[model samples]
Target chain A: MDASLLTIQPASPEPIYRQIVEQLRRLIAGGQLGAGDLLPSVRDVAAFHAINPMTVSRAYGMAESEGLLERLRGKGMAVAATVRPTQTQTQRLALLEPQLQALVRHARELELPADAVLRRLGRLLED
Target chain B: MNAMLKDAADRPGPPLAARDLGHGYEGATVLRGIDLDIAAGSVLGLIGRNGAGKSTLLRALLGLLEPTTGETRVFGKPALAMDDGIRQRIAYVPQQPEALAWLTVAQMFDYLGRFYPRWNHAFARDTLARWQLPANKLFGKLSPGERQRVELVRALASEPELLVLDEPAAALDPVARRELLREIALRACEAGITVVFSTHIVSDLERVASDIAFLHQGRLLLHCPVDDTKERYARLWLPARLGPHAPASTLGRRSHADGSVSVVIERDAHGRWPDEAAQPGVRLDVLGLEDLFVEIAE
Candidate 1:
């Protein structure tokens, strides 16, 4: 899996580590990541994100705890076989609802109608 | 989270742990009873005032300086006695970007690249091009910021698990600093490399750092998540007519109960203020990492 698939939101109250875990979880559940796919080494991820390795470790630890990944001895971490797709999707959507609501609210505040918003959304989906 | 903890629990030993670390030079104590732990693949930020002994602590960790007392361990091995194999997994970038004066950028990189087994040539070349750094420029002739970038490129190209950078952005201009940080961020994301860099620039730390450790008067003042610090720490601006008495619970640099004043405080999210404290003349503002540093260090 491409390590750049991870995204962090610093402005949100959620810590970067948690954000990393959540994003990875979403990708794994969405089939963007496959079981046994090797994740980037901790140093690479930390350096790429310009964050401390401890933060990445925490996120990785969280994912491992959730059975979404496994840290193989000598080898780096990989997606776990036991990840639950439906459960993860539900969790991700629940986590995303507030942000989606805020985006829709702001769109409405900007006087964008439902049809215009849906059209833009459709265009985005098509892309 | 459970699986991670289980894995961590099942692991036979600690990754990096320091205990009661103390250091001094010629009877002048620099750091005392310093204790820290860094799991593999985690980044840790070390922050402090000018004389707070941050460099000393780093040197102690690197075994460049002998700690007067206590123990330092990396991956459960004694830090001082680490073998070349262990050392190969770690990299250090000092505060001053130092290199052989006569070596050109490419020559310098070529020379250092020989020592590291995991040196990424393609990445180095890409970084050189992306940063617009001239490969032919003499090390000594380059500007301070350029020199710093060279040091960063050298460190990043090595692909070490633990990279310790000492104020890599100090000499960089605003744009260069941002670009350098962005590059570092990108690399970290790609490699899962652990990083610990020291910097006085709080906003830069805020931009990328996940964990922050504040050192003051030769000791660690606080170590916590950046967000937690921002949420719990605040600076309260109060008027002079409030009287000579300062708020008893707050940690502040200065207080003027008799005049307009600003007080820094660490309070719970739902904290309440005294009736007198809530007067019309008072204002409250959250303290950024810099403000918190000043308050704690002072």
Candidate 2:
């Protein structure tokens, strides 16, 4: 992996390590990463993103514990071979659920109608 | 084994510890009573407003300056009496580089390298070349940014166990700042080096610092893990009608013209909000690190 594609918002209230864990989960579920794909080393990811390595290692550890990744001796982490990513379509949608809920909340706060929100969402999806 | 590494792990106490540390100059106090312990393998970000005595605290902590009250310990030994072995294990970079203005960059490095047996000359040479700093140019002739980078290079080349940097990226561009952060992270992760750096850049602190120390008016107000600030603190707004219900232990209490009260509140030990937070018409807003700083600092 280039590792550069994995980015984090330091200013976000969420912990940096949790951000990495969630991003990796999404990538794996979306098929950007698959079984047997080599993940970047903690050192490389930390150096590339200017983040603490412990944070990266913690993210990898969480993914490993959840069966998304497995450690190879002296080779760092890799996508777990046994991961069939069950319910991937739902998993991918689940990733966007928070943002979608946020958008609907904002629309409701603005007193926008449901049809207007659906039209806007449809336009954005088409784009 | 390196004495620094041995001292870090074998010692029963923190690598750097201060007890009621206070300092003054000409009857004017700079640091108030302070008690702190910097654990091994932790990156502590020291943050404060201007004239908050951050430098004085660091100087006192490292034994560069004698405190008017209390004491500091380095590796469980009195900081004021560190021997050559202890001295060799620590590296400090002051905010401004003025100690070796008379020597060229290369000469300065060469002179300093003699004092540190394990100095990595290759790192100094490669970093200087990569940073586009002239090896033969007088240290005084370099721009502030270049000077700071040279100091950083010198500090890292020493491979010390305890690295103290005072605003290490104050003069650098954004790109240089990022590069410096990466280097700091790499050192802490690979070598398990304990680091204490004071920085005005909160975002950089958020990214790499494991712990944060907030100094306000020479007093240490908050010292906690970086992530805790977000999940543990919030702003609670009380309507004027419920003004009497505001928590008394809150911080940064303010009364707006609308006759409402806003105060900074923290989760209890059991992770529950205050009783007033459950009242109707009360609003609670979670605070980010920067917002938390502003709320309390302002």
Candidate whose DockQ is highest: 2
What's the DockQ for every one of the candidates?
Answer: 0.12, 0.44
Model 2 chain B scores worst on lDDT over the 10 consecutive residues at B1-10
Badly placed stretches (over 4 Å) of model 2 are A86-127, B1-13
> Any residue pairs clashing in model 2, and if so which?
none
Model 1 interface CAPRI class: incorrect
Tens digits of per-residue lDDT for model 2 on B1-298? 4665665567665779999999998988989899999998889999888899999899999999999999999978899999888788789988877878999999999999999977999999998887788999999999887888899899889988889999987877788789888988998898888899998889999999989999888889999988788888888888899888999754588888999988899999999988887676677776767888878877
lDDT of 1 by residue, B108-141 (tens): 8898788888888988899878777999989999
lDDT of 2: 0.86
Per-residue C-alpha lDDT of model 2 across residues A16-35, encoded as one tens digit per residue:
88788898888888778889
Best by lDDT: 2
